[model samples]
Target: MSHIPYVPASTRYDEIPYRHCGTSGLQLPVIALGLWHNFGDDRPFQTQRDIVRRAFDRGIFHFDLANNYGPPAGSAEENFGRILAKDLAPFRHEIIISTKAGWNMWDGPHGFGGSRKYLLTSLDESLQRLGTDHVDIFYHHRPDPDTPVEESMLALHHAVTSGKALYAGISSYSAEATKEAAAIMRDLGTPLAIHQPSYSMLNRWIEEGTPSLLEAAQEEGMGVIGFSAMAQGMLTDKYLGGIPDDSRLASGKVNKDFFTDEALGHVRALNDIAAERGQSLAQMAVAWVLRDQGASLTTALIGASSTSQIDEAVGAAQNLTFTPAELAAIDEHAVDSGINQWWGVTASR
Candidate 1:
């Protein structure tokens, strides 16, 4: 309960493995908790607190958030701030908090995009809502087509240099844009630290296209964190029989068109592979993203609605290896399932 004094598990560090985030000295849990869903005001506050507490107990110190994560927008951050104030504030030094801007967060013209005014103001607001003076990483949520990439990178540079954010990150960026952004940040002396891309068994955009986003991040010496590793729960077993009444698809949170019969067929095949490997489909999906495929990702960002999901995701670190045969089998069914809605925005410029 929120009223009870909280104490983290002493064996928390021993529960999961940590990897260096790119070439940086900073290390992150192989699986980080994402507040993209279920942390909003629509969910019960107690349920939110339980999930956060369970994640930390499982050794997930990294918490990823964004400005427009809630149905009302900004409520996820506000709820997380309350959790931090009540339970996690004492362990702040052990936590890595990250938040992003660049998405539409307000109604006015200057409310969104990569403009310095918007990004800077959003960071200040995020800090306030997070109940902290700084975030470990501040990201430009996506590539702004109209705004020059230079302007966005400069805003992130300012975020780090001004001590409001210790690092800079970009999400859903094309490989070319990633290179350009990384160069600008490098020249600005900020050195872009991470790239968050949507990658999963069903959506492999980051690995498609020339050079691939994975290669670009590795080449630029930036860490890679793959969000939606479970493909908006498509890669999980929840939809195998059919969309559950309580599922995201049934709730209309995700595109109904994405779960075409062809895609579901591929999912079924992948689920078989996971079972053969003695893991759940969700666990396999997370591990697959963290697999040491030439350009190894630094971490897998998973959105969890309950403590069980957090446990399954963190358990992914226990077995990240895949035999050549396993990889070959997965290749047959890991084809893109038309679930990447962000591809248009990412590849726009």
Candidate 2:
């Protein structure tokens, strides 16, 4: 499958920096591409391919995916694989690819959960779909209470040892579960390299508890990469004007119930602050998440529905810095919009 020979860009936006994943030798860009939306079966292949190339051109080297990210589950990986086989194969080792396997993928028991059977088998299928022999990071998409913690950790350990994954991570787990998983991974000699958690202006639960749990991993040497950093575009001004036709809300992918009047008010206020700072609402929202005072993060996993959005998001890297006063203003104005309520608060398991 010969692609139209996209000559890779020689220079990327220098504003975006790469940080090491915990104590590991791998470094991920501050912003990463996520396939949670827009890379499904319904979208055109060339368009998605263009978006992927644009992301890489801007130094977004990590692309995150999950088994159930598409409307027809597995389609995201299948689509991504097409791009990989065409244009990305030449830069495989230069990029860091990641995928998860903890959500529902099939109809029966083997389809989902943290059991060794599910996780391992899912990885093989994921590898096939992504057109890769191994992923840079393999994550347990979620914790399974029905399956023992040790069992899940062992599966992750196997992924690294078998050379199917360079590092292992867990997502959407409670603070307690994170600590326990980290401990077992440590004892098994795998040493968790990272934890993928949902974090955004509207979701501060991880800031309260999960960070503390990650501290133990940090001590043991594991970095944290936040996912959904924009709260499904709710943090942006896309919904402030009553859901534009081009917005995700208009696509019916995200539920309309999240577009509350209160959320819109907060977005408008944040937009005003962003205007003062000479940044777009989306830029400010992303800059806010990545702007760490002392404990800076390794990367932010974000999604884009179009190539224009991808360019805008990559440009937001320039607005990463904020002053003490600006930070205070954001804290005062931003709402942990409950868009990530399930993972940020009660739903974490």
Candidate 3:
């Protein structure tokens, strides 16, 4: 099938809210599109293209990806590259494209980790696959327990100074690591841009303050972006009644055991609050993340399986404010669902 000529919505910017990135002049939409799952080789290219188009039409300008974000790995960037070439190339300057280096990409020792070799080489590969001169934000995907933080941060500095990436970020780094990494970037004069972590109403780790990682970023003037804001469908309406036969949670990375009766009870309670707010449960979940941004978070990095899901998430900006009573009610049910797909992937290693 031939691709249709894309025309963006005229009211694109009306409902979306943009916030400053810490003290940096750079600003990002309250919600960012994360190509973590759907934009891969396994999915239809046109669907991927449509989702990107709809997201931009809804005022989302940030497209976040990592080097290894696909079933076969690296397919997300390659696929998005085609979409960019065919459709979004003309609007490149209007988008904030970011890709991370770290995580497994190629074989051998140099293919992964936070070392200078892996980070820089992987970024070049990401740029090649992204079909761009430079990404708006480049991140060292995670802390390298094996490599020194200074070494990893220096490569991020090199990425910015070399003009391959305009800004720098980190993901899944703990409070101590965030402070150390931010200091390294500050000393190098790159200055940390943002930090991505697995956060949602279900996980509640950020709220737990194991040490308050976002607090560290705030003091250092770096921004926060929360990923997995829906808890892999737990915080959404899908599991409120009970996991549907076709639910993604029925069989996926998330163990079925985590979706306990108690967890569903929480989801049901939350859904009632969302209904009272005149929004879907997923919208409420995303908005709750943005509500604490700048105060504790910056952007909610959302991943969607369908374009309508993106539309629903964008609609979240319509009603972000929560009453003290609503928040207190939320606190009543936002217990740890005991499932973190992110940690399930990384923590064991």
Candidate 4:
């Protein structure tokens, strides 16, 4: 199929709201698009183009990526680069593109971790794959237990100071690590702009610990963008009738034990609450994470296989408020279900 000329909707910024990233002057869409799953080479390119275009049309200007997003690793960024060249190139100034390093991207000893070499080299490769001079936000991806926090943060400082990335971020760091990283970045004069973590109704690890990751980000004046806000699709209505033949759970990509009777029971109860609030379970989950529950998140990073999923996620911004009773009811079913894969990474520090 041949592609037509791209023209974004003139009313693109009419619906979704943008929130300031922490205390910074930069603002991001309350709901952003993440290419962690669907933008890989395995998926049809047309579908990826449609989803990304629809997200931009709906006012979601932030697009998230990483070095290892695709099944083959780096395919997501390459694919997204194609999309950028074909459709979004003209609107580059309006988009917020973020990519990360720190995960394994190559086989050699220097392929992974928070060391300056891997982080900077991976970022250069990311910029190449992204077809851009600089990303709006550059993240360290995760905490590296072996590398000194100073080394990792200094690399990020260099990323910004050298003009490869406009701002610096860290993902999956614990409360203590986040504070230390933020302090280092502050001392370096770059100042960590954001913290990305896995957060959903079922994976509430960010809400754990004495200071809690949320509180730490708040104190450091760093914005929060939560990934896996839908708990890898488990928080959606798809699992209500048991895993469908086409679902991620049925494909063995997600652990089968994650849908234990206990977890499903909680999901079903949460679904009822969503119904009462005139929202889908997925919408409720997104809203719950974006709500001002003590330490509010600036944005919720969402992945979508279809255009309608983008619509559903954007709808979350319509009802971000939760009464005390509604929050109480949700808390009952939102117990941790051992769904957070990054728990060990955050706890490693």
lDDT of 2 by residue, 10-61 (tens): 8864647888888889888989999998999888888899999999888888
What Cα-based lDDT does every candidate model obtain?
0.91, 0.82, 0.84, 0.92
* Candidate 4 lDDT (Cα, 0 to 1): 0.92
Q: Candidate 1 versus the native: TM-score?
A: 0.97
Q: What is the lDDT of residue 304 in candidate 3?
A: 83
- Candidate 4 lDDT, tens digit per residue, 1-349? 9867899999999879899999999999999999998888889999999999999999999999999989789999999999999999999999999999988999998899999999999999999999999999999998888888888999999999999999999999999889888888888899999999999999999888889999999999999999999999988999888778988787777888788899999999999999999999999999999998778999999999999999999898899999999999999999999887785254234
**Candidate 2 TM-score versus the reference:** 0.94
Each candidate structure's TM-score, on Cα atoms with residue i matched to residue i, is 0.97, 0.94, 0.93, 0.97
Which pairs, if any, clash in model 4? none
Instruction: Candidate 1: give the clashing pairs.
Output: none
Question: Candidate 4: where are CA atoms >4 Å away?
Answer: 1-3, 344-349
Evaluated at residue 220, the lDDT of candidate 3 is 83
For every candidate structure, what is the RMSD over all alpha carbons to the true structure, in angstroms? 1.5, 2.3, 2.7, 1.5
- RMSD of candidate 3 to the truth, in angstroms, is 2.7
Ranking the candidates on lDDT from highest down gives: 4, 1, 3, 2
State in Å the error of residue 73, model 2. 0.7
Clashes of each: 0, 2, 1, 0
lDDT for predicted candidate 3 compared with the true structure:
0.84
- The predicted structure with the larger lDDT, 1 or 3, is 1
